[model samples]
Target: MHVESALRTQPRAAEGERVETAERVDAVERAGLARSVEHTMAATSTVLQDFLDGRVRAAAARSDVAARLWADLADGVGGKLMRPRLAVAAYLGIRGGHGDDDSAAIAPVAAAIEVLHTAMLVHDDLLDHDEVRRGRPNVAGATRARLVGRGLKERTLADQVQAAGLLAGDLAIASAFALVASAPADPAALLRVVRLLAEGIETTVVGELLDVTGALSSPRDVDALAVAELKTAAYSGSMPLVVGAVLAGADDAQVARLGAVGSALGVAFQLADDDLGVFGDPAVTGKSVLSDLREGKRTELLRRAYAMADDAGCALLDAHVGRADLDEEGAAAVRRVLVASGALDAVRELTRATGLRARELAVDGVPEPLGGYLVGVVDDLVGRGH
Candidate 1:
């Protein structure tokens, strides 16, 4: 029922990694994906999660401290697995295989992406001084809370919490790389996949450093949008898509186009997260509205607001935003400036623009059902609050 040509990559693919080619394509296709996209993502998520759980438990068994630390770290693991889902879609789309087809080859990389995402989030929370994530106590937060309950105070509490977060994040990163390396792919393809991970980490590290040192301090410095792309879009967005397509034996042009599609989506996703940080209800977003304002996160929204605001609006932002003692009243005042200055709406428009761009690119870059599917992915991504 499938065209032989559909199973072959362009001539350029032969110059790179060896394509699975037509002889084996039908066998691979028949081996899995007898279902649909939903089944594919669900199966992929299951595989990676099992890997994460098994590896984590094995490591935790090594010591009491390891067990306690990982228990706290595990609390951060459950999420939408958006990264893994995207990777699975790209793989199936390129390979012309469906859920349950050729899954053994894709599972490790998919799981690796999710593990890496958890690692980045853990480190990001520590850097941001966040005490909660996904409606519960995070690694640093849960540990710090327990310590406080036991009467641990001041520098001692800070010291212990930081150590726990750092170690846990390190373990996840190590495991992610290891998992991907173990994927059953060509040596060349596997190397490329591993390189993507390393590059993502490199880009994210700079992004985090810029954010911590105050990205908005100088007009010459990197803007918040740039920071968001580097920090989030690189690893969380493009890299997942790239890894999936690469394993599926896509050509260079296809790879680049898919990367572009993912970058656009990733940027949109980050911008939406920026909006949620200020405006969304904590009950739904599971994150504090006050943290972004109190931390004075240099989001594009905040930048636009400062640029468009009246002197009075500027004065209010300067006073309450970034104040450690900032309460609900101060936060409300800051939110007012964000609204009155029209920056909130502007950022929302930017998010929409990015999503639209991704939709267009998806049509041009990806194949039939896959392109349509990614367009739907874009729609949901931009519309999300959490």
Candidate 2:
């Protein structure tokens, strides 16, 4: 899902050795991909700005709140743009290679994916009571900050801010559909894109429901994997790839193959993220390493750890896993138990196997240049250090 990392240039061949034509071609494609990512970001900004401007003009009396909300949503746009990049990559891959005309044609679709991502993140943050994302204050956090500045008490401030965050998420979801619906593509393709987007959204909602239920009740590995597939895999990975391929008129077989590839890669990405949430460096990941353990997120990692642990280890887990006041010492204890139980290794192996499957699918289904790029994406996402 870290699309930017995948697009980075690898080291050049030894100075004395000549580069092959394939390598040179790959270089060009990589540059095009980087530029396309930038293009998508800019186009997304334009779409958001135009929409916000229209809203402001239509209701001058509410313009202040509207503008503030727009700013909050806009601040959320500068992520890695993974979903949008996936859409563009799929389109270009299916179309043979990058073309300016094609890139222009797919820009709206790419922008819509990013808009939808923003909406999901806003809602996710509200659900998690998380105040930050990508190293910045999230919509809910910013709303709370603004209200606090106006001298509202804590309870009232939290209520108002949460409501505002909900509305912001709703706006983003509505705008995402509008962008895709209005994209200037073939009428049939546009309809397919809309349907795909709706399916992705619905699946994610179901996944969220499962996640909440699992967290409150029993957290099983099977249930966790299901959540990953429906929540992160469908929306973050498969939808963008499938949507892009659909736009390019890919055949059903090809579309299905790419969806499988995307789902595998997405599940791998989430599993790796679960590892990082507990073990990655805070400075590098831009989030607290203890957050997941403190919250007892019931990820596959935790479930595995619990399953593998002895009675004493289980006792330790029970003592501190979900403690709201879980400090560094408590987290360290849980970490020790997790490592001793070999759960981390199990999760890592699962991620590696899943990533390998995704690579296989990409190599078999997608053509060269694009296939290689997607393979690299899976590699970067699965093996990322942070």
> How many residue pairs clash per model?
6, 0
* Model 1 / residue 73 / CA error / Å: 1.9
Q: Please report how far candidate 1 places residue 134 from its true position, in Å.
A: 1.1
lDDT of 2 by residue, 1-386 (tens): 57655545334344324557667887787667656655655665566567656654654567788778877887786567788878888887787644446655677788788888889999988998988888788888898877787877789998987987898899888888877876778989999999999999999999988887777764434468888998899999999999999998999998999899999999999999999998998777665878887778878998898889999998999899878899999999999998999998999999999999999999888766667788989999898874
Show where candidate 1 strays beyond 4 Å: 1-35, 149-153, 215-222
**After aligning candidate 2 to the native by TM-score, how far in Å is the CA of 11 from where it should be?**
33
Per-candidate TM-score against the hidden true structure: 0.86, 0.87
**Per-residue accuracy of model 1 over 1-386 as CA lDDT, tens digit each:** 25656556545577454445643553444334334555766666777667766766886779767877877876688688889878888888888865355677788788888888989989998887776888788899988877887776698999998998899899889888888887878889889888988998999998888788773483224388888888888887788888899988899988898899989999999899889888887788776788888777888888888888899998888888788888998888988998999988888999999999999999877875667778878989889864
List the lowest-lDDT window of 10 residues for candidate 2: 9-18
TM-score of 1: 0.86
Residue pairs with clashing backbones, model 2: none
Question: How far does residue 320 in candidate 1 sit from its true spot (Å)?
Answer: 1.1
